[model samples]
Target chain A: MGLIDNINKLFDHRIRLGIMSILMVNDDVDFNRLKELLDVTDGNLASHTKTLENAEYIKVEKAFIGKKPNTKYFITPLGKQAFKKHIDALEDLIRNPK
Target chain B: MGLIDNINKLFDHRIRLGIMSILMVNDDVDFNRLKELLDVTDGNLASHTKTLENAEYIKVEKAFIGKKPNTKYFITPLGKQAFKKHIDALEDLIRNPK
Candidate 1:
């Protein structure tokens, strides 16, 4: 496939891209932290996270920290593989441009 | 601005991204060639190229070669600088992840 074909559309959005980029290196990230990191509103973060979760790119776990709700997200194995492919395609486009 | 903020929304589309990538390397490219390179339909290519042109990221020159009308695209200085900044932000996001 061409480099353009390999560039995943899901990661095209800045919010989604930011979410995956954060998840790629970190073990797991919580809701509030992701919001703060991406500098996005709660609703914006929630919606994008839901899309990633639906794609199975990221998995969410809900827990309680002293009775307070905490939602944490982790990148799945598939997510990591797919994101790596996308980044590789971008790098290839920059280096080769064909 | 944050890395996410630095990522240009105009380049979020694969077609537009492809167009800029090609223009960044080539001195100039014609309409049909861009269509072939991007593997997009004429309308698709036209629309994306128009978007770039509207942004002043690219300029369209009209002329005739042997009575055949030709439209060529060249990246503007502003476009080059903006694209470079966007790429740099992506690289920073990959390297620093913050």
Candidate 2:
């Protein structure tokens, strides 16, 4: 496939891209940590995470830590594969530059 | 600046990204060539080019080649710099994966 064809539309948004980038190296990330790392508001982070979740790219886990709600996210196998393809396509675009 | 901050919002779209990618290496590209390369409709290409033009990232030239109108695009210096930065940030994101 063409490099452009490998660029996934799901990661078009910067927030989503950031989420995936963080998840790629980290085992799991929490909601507040994501918000802090991405420097986005709670609502903004929530909505973007929801989009990733809906696409099954990232799975969310909600639990309680000493009665405080803790929400964390993990990149699914499909997410890692898709993100790797997207990054590879981007690198190819830079290197090939047609 | 953070790697994410280096990612330009203007290049978030695949079409726009493709346009810049082509312009980065080629001296100049005509409208039809860009349309063919990006595989986008005339209207879609026009709108995305307009956005880049509005940002002053690209310059448009209009002429007639034997009575047939031709539109061509060239990337500005500012555009080249910004695109380079964006590409560098993407590479950093892949390499560092923070």
Candidate 3:
């Protein structure tokens, strides 16, 4: 939604894209780690994650490093494909801006 | 959610991304045109449009060609900037698909 207004439900908003960017880099990242990397608020991050989860772009893994309960996130196979396609579509837009 | 599962609050969803894509091409595609181009339902298009409108990415112009009611949409200046940035980010991802 930030700058990509005309674009479809693919890659437009800021926060949702940010989450995907980080996950694209790391094999699997946790909630706290994502929060730290992106510097997003708790509630904001939660809702955004919920949206992605509903879309099934990312899979949540509830576990713990030691004692503390933690939620880890990783891009699903499907998510990876989406990320690639989104990038392709974005590249097309840039190559041919209107 | 189809393929882009891991990305962030940015350009991750399918429907939203689709809408942006069509708008990116045509200057001012109408509701029916968009719905037809994107093959989306009325409520779905409405909700997505609301989100983009709320994001201030697209401006709606309501007028009549000749008594028949009408509405139109165009990308905002800010939305243009965001689209460019988003494309750059997406390019980065595609170049290095992790």
Query: Which runs in model 1 stand beyond 4 Å of their true positions?
Result: none
Q: How many angstroms is residue A91 displaced in model 1 relative to the true structure, after the best TM-score fit?
A: 0.6
All candidates in order of lDDT, best leading: 1, 2, 3
Two-chain DockQ for each candidate model: 0.61, 0.55, 0.13
TM-score of model 2 vs. true structure = 0.95
Locate the minimum summed-lDDT window of 10 residues in model 2 chain A: A1-10
TM-score for each predicted model, relative to the true structure: 0.95, 0.95, 0.56
What local lDDT does model 3 show for residue A84? Answer: 68
Q: Deviation in angstroms for A53 in model 1? A: 1.1
User: TM-score (0 to 1) for chain A, all models?
Assistant: 0.96, 0.95, 0.85
TM-score of predicted chain B versus true chain B for each candidate: 0.95, 0.95, 0.82
Highest lDDT, which number? 1
Q: Can you write out model 2's per-residue Cα lDDT over B1-98, one digit (the tens) per residue?
A: 34466778999888789899999998899999888877788998999999999999899999999999999999999999989888887777667856
Question: Candidate 2 chain B — worst ten consecutive residues by lDDT sum?
Answer: B1-10
Docking class of 2: medium
lDDT of 2 at A51: 94
Candidate 3 local lDDT, A1-98, one digit each (tens): 22233443634555677678778777888887777765677898898888888889998999877999999998888877887676665655445533
